[model samples]
Target: MKGTASACGSATVINAIATGEGGAFAIDLRVKSTVSLTGDPSEISGKVGNTEEDPELIEICVEKVLERRGVRDQYGAQIETNTELPIAVGLSSSSAAANATVLATYAALGGEIEPRDAIEIGIESAFNAGTTVTGAFDDAAASYLGGGVVTDNESREILKKIDIDPEWRVLIYLPPGRSYTTEVDVERIEFLGDLVEVARESALEGNVFGAQTVNGLIYSSVLGYDSQPALDALSAGAESSGLTGTGPAIVAVSKEKNVEKIINVWNSKEGRVLKTRPSREGARIENG
Candidate 1:
């Protein structure tokens, strides 16, 4: 039997709220999609291609999972992705791709899945696929639910969803280079032990705007990246600004009236700047 499914996974900016014990909140954006498969895997074994963006990790992941499931040589499938989200730029590209591909493939296989359950499955798949650190349950949950979500990455637990004012516009700054999350020294993160508590408290108070800034500052210091641009955005009238994930990408929460101003400042720097809105809906199946 052969089957196909398509899923959309959003990009995450950071863990807004994180406990020293490891709880986190994520801001999600839906701008990328993935397709998955479950028939004649051998047909796509050597047919996969890379286009400057290193999607090889994701492809290899799918192949390995299928092979382990004893169905590697029995499927022929193609995954084509169209995305505005940049990979390896700390925009949750990998997570989005993983969720989309898994959902698509499951659909192709004639399987059924609940929305939240599917995101959980994607988290497990990503860990097994070696494509993520911390399993990123916060990011995964945000990608699945849209808007903002708080979660425990270790336990794959969702703590809460904070409703963001619709008037907010999310703007991103994309540096010319990519930073791999895996390459980040875990020691650096561990070094910021005390700061995690401060950030987590900010998130719990529903002060995500402050939470993102603090989290970004801590990570920027650890990653050896500049935090000036993000801080500059805030100074320039943006509501909130911070680095996303381990980042080369900086994110700003702004009002539409101020989006252009935020974009101008971000573009003034030596990076690509983008403006986007929060996605209200989570993942959806385009076809059965």
Candidate 2:
């Protein structure tokens, strides 16, 4: 049996580490995963393309799906994933990968799983792989459901899913390095819980860009990342700009008129710039 699926990546409007409540919006960047059952029932293998291989995350996703279906002892699988989203740069790459892998694995088993179940399975896989803190429910929901989502990560509940304006462009500044969520300083972020709450409230009130700016400022300060890129994006007419996940990458939201201006400002920096738009489409099976 074989299956293929794809899921979009997302940028943080509010990183949930500080407050259990967080927000995110989907982007056009995507991860695709293909799964094929093998004759060997005890061996599962995985490969990732366009970045470093993370066999552990892939295997965890596949194994979890097999176990959920009570077929873990009956089938092994070979999983392959490719992505335009950069890993460890806080673009929801892990969540997207897990979603695609889980969906693909289910399809390979000649069935489909609910999106919520797939997201939970992906969260479990992420925790097992030590790829996230707080299970990243906000990121997972945004990636799997598309558009913008405000979630209570602690409760694994989506409080809101906003259909974002598609005309807005998302500009990402990718620096040379990467920051993993597992390495974040939880204490430092939690110390400013009151501040993060304000950002979360702003997101709930439909001021997503404003919330993103607030979140970016707070996290960047606590995480010791240079906030200059985000600041420059704002100066260049971006409606919202901030550090997305942890560090080393900054995201700016703006209209088409300001996209070039923001890109020019980001291009002057040390890293490269990627341009994409908000997506209302979520994860889906590509082929059965």
Candidate 3:
């Protein structure tokens, strides 16, 4: 596969911000992209597929975007993703993949697609490809910019950028089970939308610790998942604790000194634990 464009990765809070909207926060993590177009157009596949509201649709969506750009098909392009982020566990996997694919495709073509434009386009692709519920521009932007961001998706505005104090570590708790954001019934959560807005305001006011913790509780109550794990994190002296995106994965924010205690408490239960820090950069393009 021939033309190439690539971008970095970020995380968003999703539907937790914006008036009459939801909450989202983007975190910077590891991300890179590579694109190739050859005479051979190979079928791409991964653990992510159309089954169970598969978040892997982000890859397919990128391919479709490439096709729409008319740079592929005639020349053809292939995208491969390698990341530590898990799918359907509310970790912004789709947003990261979309950011990488679009930026790599642009790089391969040697054209100019501003980072902001690239992020907006990637969000649109996720919507068109049926992988997202509300276009998820907040998540897309965080995935694009790599620092903490609060965005209003409906108005297409960024309300704030929070420079996470590097002293903090983001510890994520992943249960063996998976939950898809696309599969969630928005109408059922609509009643809780007001609570989501409250969380959003706290996030914009530089209360991310409070925002994430409260957002996690609100979504947990609505989604019918256990909030005990997150509570446990907070109980262990974490600076902040809450759900990551929708369900199943609980995030705890803490200083380096508290890492072992947090991990010990998390692993004491039945779950997978990941220790990570905020990524300061977004996406990039590379060569074979």
Candidate 4:
């Protein structure tokens, strides 16, 4: 049996480590996963097309899905993932991959599961694989459901779903290296809980741009990243700008009129820049 699925990536509005509550918006970057089950129950493998492969995450996703369906010992699977989203850049690549893989595995098994259940399975797999800190429910929800989401990561509950202006553009500035979530100092981030809560409240109140800027600034300072790129983007007329995930990748949200100006400024920086729009569509199984 074989199945295929796709999920978009998301940018952070509020990192959850500080407050256990977080917000994120879906972006156009995507990850696709294909699963093929083999008769040999002992042979399981996974490969990533663009970046370094995390076989443990992929394996756990398949295993979790199979176990959920009570068919873990029935078959082994081969998983292949291809992504436009960059890994370890705080773009929700791991969440997207896990979601797509879980969905694909379910499709291959000819079964259906609640969307929330599927997302939880992916979250569990991520935590087990050490790819996440607070389970990243906000990122997973945004990537799975699309648009924007405010979530209680610890409780794995989505507090709200938001719609972003579709006309706005998202600009990402990827620096030279990647920062892994597992490597982050959780205690230091949590020290900013009081401030992050203020940003989280702003997001809940629909002031996403302001919240994103503030949250990004907080994480950037605590994570030891340069905040000038975000400041530069804001100076270039971006609607909002700040660090997206943990570090190293800055995101700038802007109107079409300000996009070119922001891009021009970001181009002068050290790393490359990518332009995309907020995704309103959720993860789905693709027809073969």
Tens-place lDDT per residue, model 1, 74-143, is: 7655555555567678777666666665555555556665766667667776776566767777666666
Worst 10 residues of 3 by lDDT: 3-12
lDDT (Cα, 0-100) at 70 in candidate 4: 82
Local accuracy of candidate 2 as per-residue lDDT tens digits, 40-140: 88899899985566678988999998988998899999999999998889899999999999999988888989899999999999999999998999999
lDDT of each: 0.63, 0.91, 0.68, 0.91
Encode model 4's per-residue lDDT on 1-288: one tens digit a residue. Answer: 999999989999999999899999999989999999998888788998755666789889999888878888889999999999988898999999999999999999998878899899999999899899999999999998899999999888888788997789999999899999989989888889999999999999999999999999999999999999999999999999999988688999998999989999989978999999999997999985
How many clashes would you count in candidate 3?
Answer: 38
Candidate 3: TM-score?
A: 0.86
Mind sharing the TM-score for model 1?
0.83
Clashing pairs in 2: none
Ranking by lDDT: 4, 2, 3, 1
**Cα RMSD for candidates in order:** 3.6, 1.1, 3.3, 1.0
Worst 10 residues of 1 by lDDT: 16-25
Error of model 4, residue 260, in angstroms: 0.8
Query: lDDT, candidate 3, residue 53?
Result: 41
User: TM-scores for all candidates?
Assistant: 0.83, 0.98, 0.86, 0.98
